[model samples]
Target: MTGTDERPDAFARTDDGVSVAYQCRGDEAGRPLVLLAGQANNHHWWDGVREDFHGTARTITLDYRGTGASDAPRDGYSTPRFADDVVGVLDALGIERADVYGTSMGGRVAQWVAARHPERVRRLVLGCTSPGGPLAVERDASVRRALAQPDPDAVRQTLTELMYSPGWIAEHPVPYGTLGDPGMPPHARRGHLVASNRHDAWNALPSVVAPTLILHGDQDRLTPPENVPLLAARIPDARAHLLPGARHAYFEEHREAAGALVREFLG
Candidate 1:
């Protein structure tokens, strides 16, 4: 199947028989960099910022079970399972290990990837994500209410506000694809929501052996900035950085600086 970018999609069948779709781009000789997207989002979540890594790494992106070209089973939607899907992709591609970067819910999955399969991750970058659970700081009540708004327009507006600053959004009046997979089924969406909500990687976080970098936006209202220290404290030797004046989509809002930081760290 061809993806939105017209690249042919590759398939990897999970142990449970679900087919996950992935796409690879950039320098073939470059090191592999696996990018995990946020809640309900497909590979396109990185559309705005993925090219920044192309010069130095082969960027790999995939759709979760319910999104994009992947098969959506009624069951198996937890972060750990999502991590397993990532491993399936790597195994199918004959990649033994690679650098990993995840954002939002994808970061939650990356936590499991590094923790459960430490041998498969060379370095880790967690962007605009929380550790998830009581130890992690959550969004404010107002933000939560806005996110839960029933109207699609309201949700998009809320997401836009949460993702980028007013100035940035005004300057770049284009879609960031934050709405996730347009064709996602209701069950898959619900599963993603439940899985992300129930994510509790506190006990497993210490097991993550990969060198980790935790990045967040100082002005973020979605995940909040306070969670960065909490994540850094749990993951041994983890470094934390905050992007000034950025929100949830800090990686996209400040791509140059964020990309430089990632490139340097991975190198």
Candidate 2:
């Protein structure tokens, strides 16, 4: 999967009846680095960031059950179900184990995956995410309002405002545009966010045997650092790093450092 000119396209269907969308690049047979996207985002979340990871490993990215190019089963998508989707994707691609990275809502699913299926995950990298359930001052009011925000464009605007800082939105037009596209799976978004708000894996953190690297933006408004301490204290041997002046999309805003941390952790 290695080559700068080679870009992420799409993976075909697995036997379980879901047409998993994925892109492969970097080392052909190296340990797979699987990327899971945030809430309402598809496989395209790692669009530019793929190059950073592709250099050292074979990168595999999949749009979870209700996001991106994958099948959006309106009825079958919660946090745990999203973890199941990863299992399905790995099984479909014939991958038994992989290094995993996720952010925000994606990070939640990755936690569940790593905890529930430790054997399948070699290492874990979490960014701008939470362990789950009522972390800090979780204002369900705004989130709920955002959920029923009239229509797609409104939803896009609402999420963009909450997810990224004004500087990030201004400088990074690509993801800003990506977030505002409004082509996301609504059912998945509503379901996932609701689940994420109330879900907590604090007790389960002790069971995750895989090496873990947690990254969060110092200025993150989405998953505030206030709640991250619980994650660090609970997860054994898990290291947490704070990115200066970064928002929720810290990985992209500070791509070099984010990539470096990931490379180091994965190594």
Candidate 3:
């Protein structure tokens, strides 16, 4: 509803009764495409990339539980539960299959979806994400400390550095200033982080039958690009793409190029 598309703002109730908010854009009859955001972020973060798929596919973006307009449950915030929320949305919309694109923590959830519900996923795009658990390449202590900053401006500055290349940040000041701020309360944010920390997709990767595209920024500090190849090698039919000079927000920092790659792969 927030995009150029005319679809109404909608909500789908998950099996546990949490209400998940989502929006649909592009051609409904076209291939269904689901966009999942990273940790502490919501569906609105996909605004910058959704336009690229406008006429080619039906783009669906949803708020994970405890973020955006979705109802935050007191518990059950694990990656598996998050994956079920996605499938719940698909079932509510009467979609039999979809191509899923996830970033950061959302990618972990997407892995669960593809592994646990293989019949429902046609393809997967894991951007700036990791396989999770002990196999995941974690950020340095300073980066982790930056994430824990309480000041909004400090948090933004730290995130900009962690997410975008210097050139991209300088060129896109406005977008950088208005980055998607997940309005979850402190407790909810903590819960989300806990869920992220618990994600373990290593065992599930080999079972994901859907063809996968693992895209990462060459300069990503949060999830090192080295994890890309390791992740690709684990999946049966996975491809890895390293965007030169881009950071964790590679898809956003290199919007046109990254979007083109996604379009080509999804086509």
Best by TM-score: 1
Candidate 2 residues lying further than 4 Å off, grouped into runs, are 1-17, 135-158, 174-181
TM-score (all chains, Cα) for each model: 0.97, 0.85, 0.94
Regions of candidate 3 where Cα sits further than 4 Å from its true position: 1-3, 175-182
**Model 3 steric clash pairs:** none
**Taking the tens digit of each residue's C-alpha lDDT, what string does model 3 give over 214-263?**
89989889888878987898899999899988888888878888999998
Compose the digit string of candidate 1's lDDT tens values, residues 12-102: 9999999999999877778999999999999989888887887788889999999999999999999999999999999999999999999
lDDT of 2 by residue, 1-267 (tens): 344554655655544466667767777767788888777677667776777776678877777655667776656566777777787778867889999898887888888889899999999988888777644444356666775766967876766766667877787674452362156556766765666665677777788888899998887766776657777777786989998888777887788998898998898
lDDT winner between 1 and 2, please give it.
Answer: 1
The stretch of ten residues in a row with the least summed lDDT in candidate 3 is 173-182
- Cα shift from native, residue 104, model 2 (Å): 0.4
- Candidate 3, position 95, lDDT: 95
| Cand. 2 TM to true fold | 0.85
